[model samples]
Target: MAERITLLVGGRSTEHDASLHGYRHVLSRLLAEPDRIEVGAVCYVDRAGAFHLFERAPWPEREEVLLGGQTLGPGAALERLRAADSFVFSLLHGNEGEDGGWQGLAEVCGITGNFGPVLASALAMDKHLQAVLAAALLPGLRVPRSLLVRPGSFDAGQVLRRLGPGPLVVKPNRMGASLLTTCLPEPSPSALAAAVREVFPYDDQALVQEFIDGREFSCGVYKEHGKFVDLPVAEIVSSGFFGHAEKHTKGRAKILLSPENAATRKMRAFSQSLFEATEMATFARFDYIVEGDGIWFLEANTLPGLMSGSIFPMMLAETGRSIADLVLSAVSECGSRPARDKVLAYDISH
Candidate 1:
């Protein structure tokens, strides 16, 4: 029998809609390669956690939200997922979604290429911890001076005592997307406390680092069989820094050709080290900052946004790769993995 496949899209996060857009991209490529695959369903788990199979009546173009003519609810999502022979999790941005929750569930039921288990997923999500891990593996890499703030017990005053006054960049320790990132001038002791409270809403634990003003850049890396191979480097240009809107909005962030420089070489080296250290699988993207004479590490995205024209895909095209090729490379590598066989949950026990 041909293997049954289920591609899960959407999540309860700020980027739920974006994930849906990415899913359409992945599904089209998968459907086109009919000789090598079978489709069980392409389901959408709405931002509210409501699950529904792709219905033709809802979406005019059936290929966009194409389905197997079977509707599944939230309760049935995982059940049907458990029964599939293969799976694709086309999620983008957000804590509950890409941060690892869905991948964990996929593990329990059996789905291929769902990234690592909960801990790896959990560890990779936070910017602070990612820095901590990167520091261990690539000591030569430049990272900003920063501090980690755990939930409940936070005092900006105490933080200031260690690295005092002015020019601070603070972000959530556990979340991705520049959602609640703050860049502040030197603040009075009283004002520092308020700023700390501001970041509290985003993450219980946070990382406040010394500001590194420079150009933002990212590199996408895919697995060439078993070895890690680097993709084209795309520099992000924005008036300020590349924040949430820049990443999601069309034409906000610019993906450029490689700039020949020592800094980029180091950034690539740093990226490869981080990927190996973290044991990232299949495809991933790393972010960086190029300062006057140094490049600093930024957190990476394991599941980068990939529509036909997204940055990652755009970057790949410069290297003479097509959307069809990109999808095929990723899916073929993922399918050949042992994890793919272990996780494709076509049958779930109640």
Candidate 2:
């Protein structure tokens, strides 16, 4: 029997549009290989946190608001999810989608899916925490030095002092796709204050790191037949630091299918180490900054984008694995995992 598959895309995050692209890309790829699995439904979680379902995959651009269909409220969505014999491909990015909230929901509702376990997703989402974990697990790993700025307690002077004298990268600690991320020439108190203030509305905590001017690269890690393996490294040559524009906007950045240079070898090793240390499941992507031979650990994306042009898919293509291949592999591995007891009600009877 063909496995029922639902691609969960769009979310209440800055990366919602990117998720839409990824959904369309993956859905199209899966459709091309029809005998492998059944593409059942596409669910779009809009910016306002509403669940809209489509019997057929909605047009990526036109599918914004919940159209005239069976709009699944929170409870209904959960119930449907728990009851279906389907693989939920969560192509969501940032915050509630990728920052463990969705994974936690699956855990609470006992739904089987890919991405990773709840703890791994939670650990990988926070920049500061992931860096701290890498430092502890992989000693001498050159991670960028940074400090966390919590809400209502962002002291600019204190932040500048910790990060020291250098170009600084200020970003939301838990956000991805480089949303609200900025680079300053120097970690001046005023600049740091302004950046943190801008970042605060999106997240409760922000990360400030010393900017390292180096070659940017990303490598993918995935379980092939139950063993973790590294994908090809893609060197990102961007006009500037790869941020929102470079990521979402086409032609803003160039990707090179790099050879097995010293950087790629080290990155592959780092990717495996980070994946193991984080206890990541199924798949992940680790980003790095290479300054000569010294590789600086940037971050790990638990739910990396699967858009056709995205680095993850590009790396997979270099390895001769299509999007359908990845989806099939995930389904084969995750389909048998025992489901958790579903939550029947929320106790909102007040």
Candidate 3:
């Protein structure tokens, strides 16, 4: 029997809407391989903590949407709980779902996927923490020493005195998709502080990093049951630094399979190192910047977007693998959890 694959999407992050778009596109691609997939389902969690099922009756084009065990609740919409044989998550650029919070819930209920536990998810979710972790693996990569500043953590004058750096990047600790990321150049400190206030609504903690300017590029990697699948490098060209509008708005960002320069190779090397450093399983996207003689480590997306034009699928296609095949290969590995011993029904394996 084909396993039921729940494509969890939409979260309480700034990228909630964008996550939905990613799910829809991924759903379309997975349907292409009818022989392997079964019971397609969508679970949407709104900001107010309300969960809703996307479709009531499966349409002709999407006849595999299973409603048997699915239900909506405050923060989760899941069926079969511990009984689910497998799950394929596609949450992008946001909190809740991608921030390791959702992964924690999955673990509590014994649902494992490509990535490890919630600890890794939480560690990889925030750009600042991920940067600090990458420092050990990708040596010499330019990373601004930073802090996870929460509300009332510091005063502006005191912060500047502590930083003592040329410029800084003030961003929400957990938000991706560049919602409130601001480049704070010196002599105009108030502008960045103001941007910080705007981001306060989304996250209680803000990340302040020394700004490093250079060429930005990203790469993808998929680690299955002891197998690593590395795809071609893809570069992100933005009018400015890759921010919210640049990623979502057309023509603002350019994602290509091949790089125009040698810097991309350095990016791939660093990406592989960082992935191993973080102990990331399944798949992820690593972002970087190249300066004169240094390549800066930016961050990694444990759950990189798998939408139609998203970088992960693009790189996979470059390797001649269809989205359908890639998604199955990644999702199928989640069954790696050791078979439960009937004698020890509740013995947990770490």
Candidate 4:
């Protein structure tokens, strides 16, 4: 008998749609391998933060069938989740889903989800914290010179003075998919202030870093056996800024599989080290920038998109790995441990 899988998609985050797209791709891949996969159920979290349960529905293709359903409140959803003997695949992006919120809940519920533990998820979700940790753990690694801004204390003048001149990248500290990411060619004090204000709606904290003009690349990292495996690196050749628009649009950016070279090798090494330092497990994608100076860490994605044009899937394909490989690996790692026993088992094993 095939193992059952409970795929969770959609969240009350900015990347809710991205999660839905990822679920579509993942669902299609699992359906292709019926002998190994028995998609037992799917739980959809609407933008309004409502949980709806669907029975005998493993496939989600239409809006009516996908969005319209018997509303199962949080208590019922958790009950169904706990009742199933399934590997929970949290394909959520952005805030509550990927930012250690769900991971913490899983821990409290004595369940171990697909992503890493709560600490790892939280660290990776906060870009500023991750950068600080990376710098401390790997002293030789290069992180961009930047300033961290909080909600009440966004001193644009002070930030500019410290970061120096123009072309700074302002981004939300805890969000992904490049949402609310902006590149100001000439970021005056007013421009920086406006950027911070623009990002305030998404996150309470924001990061302002000196924008490096160089090649942007992303590498996928997954843990197997007892070590981390780095996938082929892919460079993003974007016509303009590689923000949310460029990320989702198919033709906006060209993803080229970077050959094994000094730069690519360095990126892979850094990625593996970062994964270890951040305590990331299962799998993740680390993005970087290479300029005349050196390779600089951009940010890490704990739950990267598995959409048709997502970079992680493209990079895995370069190494002859498919979404099936990822799914099977997750299933094998999660095993048949019951949700109520996972935390205790994890404690004993560690």
Candidate 5:
């Protein structure tokens, strides 16, 4: 029997649009493999957190057509998906989608797919926590000096004194896509405070880190059967940091695939180690900053973007693998794994 798969996209997160765009590509790829796979549902979650099922993959240019479907509650939607006996491939990024909420829900409901382990998703979501984990677990891995601060509770003067002079990057501690993220060349106390305050509207906490001036690169990894498979390292060439605009806007960032260099070689090795150490399942994308001999750990995306021109798909393409291959492999892997026992048995009679 063909493996049934559900493509879950969009969410209440700020990355909802990107998810919608990515799912179009995923759906197209999955549909191509008619004999081996069956696309059971193309579930779309709106920004307001309502669930809607699209009978077909909506055209990338015609996102407005999404409103045509009758809205269903989350419970109703999940129940429908559960009844189909389909494996879910979530394309949703950030917030409840990426931060273990959706993964936990699926686990509880016995629905599984490319969504990774719950703890791994949550760990990858928090920048500060990931940094701390990397520092403690991966010796010799250079993580930028960072401090977690909340609006109106952190002092800018102390931040500068600890992280060093001037140049620093301020970003929401838990958000992705560089939304509201800023870099200050010459950060004054007032300017730093203002930058941190800007993050408060979107996220409760902000991460202020000493900026590393160097080349940016990303490597992807996934488990095939029980072994780890690392993809080619790609260098991201941009004016400065690869911010939201550079990522979404076409031709803004130049991606060089399989760059032959020492930094990339080391990155591939580090990526595999990190993936295993963090218990990341399915697949993940790890970003880094290379300064001469030092490779600084930037962050990891458990749910990497697959939108048109997204980096993950580009890396996959370099290896002659498409989204279809990834989806099929993930579904098989999910099936091969032993099921988790949610409840513990006790000897009450003794």
Candidate 6:
């Protein structure tokens, strides 16, 4: 029997549009392997957090097809998913989707698939916390010095005193895709304050860190046959800080796959180490900044983008692997795991 899979995409996050774009590519890839995989449904979560179920794989080329589905409430949505008995692979990014919110819900409702462990998702969401944990877990791990700033509590003078001087990167501590992320080369008090303020609209906290002037690279890791398989390391050459525009806009950045270098080996090792240490499920991608021999840990993505032109897919392609391989591996890995015992046993004393 073909493995049934339900793709969960779109979410109440800043990356909703990106999720939709990624969904089209992933859906197309999965549909191509109908003999081996059956896409039971495409569950779409709108910006307002409502669930829409598209029973038939319409192979939506545009976003409009996502609108023509039966809207479902949370309970109804869970029931629909449970009815399919399919592995739920979430493509949702940021916030409630990637930040342990959906994972926690799936755990509570006994929904299974690729929604990673709740604690790991939550840990990966917060940049500051992830860095702290990574540093503690891996001795001699180099991460940029950073400070967390919350609304109304940001002080530029204090930040400068702590992190020091120019070329600081300020980004939403919880958001990804470089949205609302900025690098101030001449970080004045006002400039730093404005950058931190921009993050407030989308996220509760901002991470201000010293910019690592080095070559940037990202590597992906996934499990196959109960063992870790690390993909080739890809180097990202961006004109600037690899912000939203640079990430989304073609020609703004160049991605080189499996670059021959010493850092490549070190990055793959680091990625695998972090992937295991954080208890990430199925798959993950880790970004880094390497200056000479010193490699700095940038961030971790439990759910890395799978859209066309995304680094994860490119890394997979370099290894003769496709999205289908990843999905199937996830199914096998997750399916073999022990199911959660949700039942509570108790005895009433006579």
Using all chains and alpha carbons, the TM-scores for the candidates as numbered come to: 0.82, 0.92, 0.84, 0.92, 0.94, 0.95
Which numbered prediction scores highest in TM-score against the true structure?
6
lDDT of each: 0.68, 0.82, 0.68, 0.82, 0.83, 0.87
Expressed as tens digits, the lDDT of each residue in 1-350 for candidate 6 is: 78888999889989998899899899888888888889988888888888888877564446677766899998999888766778998899988888999898888777887987899899999999999987897776699999999887778899999887769999999998989989898899999999998889888899999999998888888789889876788889987788889999999999988656677887788788888877788899889998878989999999999999898998788778889989999888877877767689999999
Tens digits of per-residue lDDT, candidate 2, 262-325, equal 7788788878988887777778898989897788999999889888788888878877888877
CA lDDT for candidate 3: 0.68
lDDT tens digits by residue: candidate 5, 324-349: 77887888777787786768987887
Candidate 4 Cα RMSD (Å)? 3.9
Q: Output the number of the lDDT-best candidate.
A: 6
* Model 6, runs deviating above 4 Å: 340-350
Which consecutive 10 residues in model 6 have the weakest lDDT in total?
A: 57-66
Clashes by residue pair, model 2: 110-340
lDDT of model 1 at residue 299?
81
lDDT of 1 by residue, 1-350 (tens): 33345566666676666676777776676567666556655666665666666423333123334333455675676776666555554454566766888767767766554455566567678887788888888877778889887767777678888876557877777766676766776755576566667767766877888877888888887776676656778788876656667776777866676765777777777877777767666677888888887778888777777866577877776777655555456566666756334455587789
State how far residue 32 of model 4 sits from its true place (Å).
1.0
Runs in model 1 lying further than 4 Å from the true structure: 1-5, 24-40, 55-75, 186-195, 250-253, 307-309, 338-350
Error of 2 at 258 (Å): 1.0
Model 3 Cα lDDT, one tens digit per residue, 125-173: 8777787777855665677667667677657666776778677888888
Ranking by TM-score: 6, 5, 4, 2, 3, 1
Mark the 10 consecutive residues where model 5 has the least summed lDDT.
54-63
In angstroms, give how far residue 67 of model 5 lies from its true place. 2.2
